[model samples]
Target: MQYSPDSDPSYDLKIHAGFKVVRDYSFSFDKVEISFKDMVRFIFPSTGYLIFNLFFGDDFTLRFLNYDLSEDLPHHLYITGLLSRGMLITGQQGTGGGYAMKIHPVIGYHFLRIPMYQLTDRQVRLSHIFDREGRPLRQLEANASARTLNDPGVKGFFSKYLPDKSVYLRDPVYHAVNKIISKKGIIQVKKLATECCMSERTLHRQFLLKVGLSPQSYAKIWQLHFTMELLKNNPGAKLQGIAFKAGYYDVAHLARDFREKLFVPPSQFYRDVNPMMQSYLDFPDSLQ
Candidate 1:
């Protein structure tokens, strides 16, 4: 399904935030395009999904825990690994647009053909991965626009890289991921290991290899992800209520996670950021 800001119930919130947003959830991977009328800064929360981002019209900077990364490539395409902590992104002033595809970590590992642990909390230029002469890179560049998700060029590029169905069926890590999602990140690691029919040590090793983060770390990120969703969807909801709904023990625990992972307090974050941008960081349920 495609969602436009105009047709969405949050249309007024998006317009007031100076954003034009489009989302397509029809495919296994979620695709989104967002345009900003002015310069903006926001905290994009940690997620289990590996993200591919294409930038146009302006450059952006990403600040992780200890270092800063910027996009300066001619094609302006980059793939972000599964983020373990929130990142602060700042876009330059003037009209700017970006397209992103959110991929499952298991599928991302198969597509990249490398140990996913090396990519944790990092971003790599797409040019380094794909030859400049390749059709995937060329098509992605040509279709990096407002209609990116629906464009034939983008779809054609992705078609060549889709993983096989057996990959999901045969991977224990993938099944664990589905269990984590279904529980909304509230389950214990020992229980998860038991349910997946693997020892805790084995589960940890496999999760790091396939998902770029350990099971505990991934669960924490997913918990924060769920909390963010609650905050975005319920603008007026109290912190205590939202925290409980997201499976936190209390509001203080939720606040601590925000400060630890996002580098900001919950109150300040909600007050300073745009709701539409917060929604953009959400991991879609369909992808699970």
Candidate 2:
């Protein structure tokens, strides 16, 4: 059931662009300890699965907050949901070694039998809900911290944990979700439901089960994400043009989304943000 590393195109450089921003860790599949570098702050949006972080760094302080974007207090080792608003992660940048991977949202619940609601929009630790399973997950973290990152070990781990193509194809909602993503969240819920050959209520329920978010909310997330991406990529382009291209009614509409999701106006965010940091959080290298 294991997938060959060679079969998949390399996403390492893209996924860990922030680490690369700070310093270059040449790609190598010989061992698991991917690198020894200082960690930087990056905010990962709910675009995909939960990422596993096994850091062996000193003075590491990780925290997760709600959609409220409160930085007053933060908790270490946070568990995020499919509709997780956003996360602001900060850590010391120094001698660290680790292995990390993104676990598909559906696979996490399907194979692990984790309830999506428990993690939805809440900022808590893996131990909170994974009470009995926490010990093993923590042990896995320990194991990951100890070993050097190698191709075989990484491939073996994913093959054991990730759902196969059959599982994805078997789910009816998967196709619907794919349709929404293909349109970049520019489609309507009713149309999506019709395309999926289901009623709106059924589509809502199915999306919640498979994606941990209502279809409307899921679409909004991608809309905002795409808008942000447009702004980031088109510096010389006019804001109005970007807004229209992103399917927003107007520049004000786009700004509203920016405020809601990023906790800042587009102008302020663009001025203060670092391109490298955004590349890490928003998406992979090519897309960013």
Question: lDDT of model 1 at residue 91?
Answer: 38
**Candidate with maximal lDDT:** 1
Off by over 4 Å in 2: 1-48, 65-79, 83-94, 97-100, 122-157, 282-288
lDDT of 2 by residue, 1-288 (tens): 011122233322222422211111122211122221333444444564444443344433233334534221111234445655543443323333333434445555564456565556644444445567455445545454323333343334434544455776677676776676677789988988888889999989877776778888887876777776787788788888988988989999888877666667776666655433454344331100
Q: Rate the local accuracy (lDDT) of all candidates.
A: 0.63, 0.52
Per-residue lDDT of 129 in model 2 = 53
Please identify model 1 stretches exceeding 4 Å from their true place. Answer: 1-25, 28-39, 58-68, 72-76, 130-154, 231-244, 282-288
RMSD (Å) per prediction: 7.1, 10.0
The TM-score of predicted model 1 comes to 0.73
Please give, for residues 21-59, the per-residue lDDT of candidate 1 as tens digits.
223223433333334334334446666678776554534
